[model samples]
Target: MGRAAAAEALTRVRKTLVSVPNLAKVMANSPALVKGWLALPGALSEGVIPAPVRERLAIATAQYNNCEYCLSAHTYIGAHVAEVDAEELERARDAESFDPHIAALLALSDAIARGRGRIDERQPKARRAAGVADAETAEVAGNLAPNLLADTDNEWPVVTPCTHN
Candidate 1:
């Protein structure tokens, strides 16, 4: 795409997200990539998972991937937007939760991120035991995609104190 398209993508991203993240700015260099990045999260938001659980999943996946940017961003979004408690946010980093269903989801997310999309057989069994259906378990990949995309290489010029204003 041309510069105009990239600029348009960046504009759309800012309008959709309400703020332009540094990663979004870098993604603007490839308009298609940035657009696709925006689309995945939008699509996943319509899935079975609750916003708070999804945010926890993102936190767990980010921690697994060692993406400081994603971890910080999701931590803030989890506590603020999703109303996840501070303790829950910290527990999520370890793929844990007081709610068993959410804990299962976070574990599944962490497994997916750690395995790089390949999970062990026992993981699904554990999730199923926790009342997670096959479908909801599958959606973990949907949540993992955007978190993984945020810093695929585990490197994104770490910025502490995620400023989301």
Candidate 2:
């Protein structure tokens, strides 16, 4: 079998009785979805965007969409990749305290996930002060699109499941 098919088979076999199918299985059936997932890791690791800020953006997007799977995935990634502790992740999850820049990014991501594509003036200003440039902000906003679109209750596009998020 092909790699994708093999992965899917493995996922299915591993979760014979689980109600929520493994996200890896879901992604294996969809190339575009997998592409988007791959893009996130590469973009976040590029050093232009700080890892904490990226995780906040990701977690905020997932939260706004009410995607439990994405929330869980991003939370773990935040701790692992961003080196953010569980306490910080909890605060971010609760819309409480975090690094100022990370908080602003999360707020911006929340706005986007809620269907407001444009970032507010205050948020951009805060992000700029926090060391994020306009170009970087735009990129962060763009990165959030797939997650936002996927989580829309009204849309529900045929995306592959992402086991990691």
Candidate 3:
């Protein structure tokens, strides 16, 4: 199939999985997962990290993993929730010529996705320089674990349903 066809197929599947009825049932049974997902947006909103940067990281990671669901979801969230401008979002989607800090965060997220929590020293150091505390970094790492796994498992049929435990 062509790229467009594949993307459309994925989008249809994602929409089905994340439909309100489906997610409502999942959230009702899996409160912990819901909570963790909620915490990610809460942290970003509370300034644990700049929302734009965090969204950029998410988008880059999703793209690297070829997770169509996550890429579309993060792209939407990065623009809507994070208030990232279109130009910056496009830069992140392309993973080129972005801000140094955003680039570093994307690199770190990529490492985490591939290494499964065994990121290089430079990853944490770069996050630190970006004003992300160890605690916050750890939290983000924890949040990313399941996301990466879900993407790998092809469980994300929709925009990745959020969980709030």
Top model number, TM-score: 1
Each candidate's lDDT (Cα)?
A: 0.79, 0.60, 0.58
User: Which portions of model 1 miss their true places by more than 4 Å?
Assistant: 149-165
Q: Compared with the true structure, what per-residue lDDT tens digits does model 1 show for residues 1-165?
A: 688988899899989988888888778888988888999888878988888898888887767666688887788788879999999988887889999888888888877777877999999789889999877877888887776444433233342432321
lDDT, model 2: 0.60
- Between prediction 2 and prediction 3, the one with superior TM-score is 2
List pairs with backbone clashes in candidate 3. 14-157, 14-158, 31-165, 34-163, 34-164, 35-163, 35-164, 35-165
Q: Pick the candidate with the highest lDDT.
A: 1
- Cα lDDT tens digits, model 2, 45-121, are 67466777677666666666667667776777678767988787766664545576666666666665564675556
Lowest summed lDDT across 10 adjacent residues in model 2 is found at 151-160
Q: Worst 10-residue stretch by lDDT in candidate 1?
A: 156-165
What TM-score does candidate 1 reach? 0.87
lDDT of 1: 0.79
By summed lDDT, which 10 consecutive residues of candidate 3 come out lowest?
Answer: 156-165
In candidate 1, how many Å is residue 84 off? 0.6
For model 3, give the RMSD to the true fold: 10.9
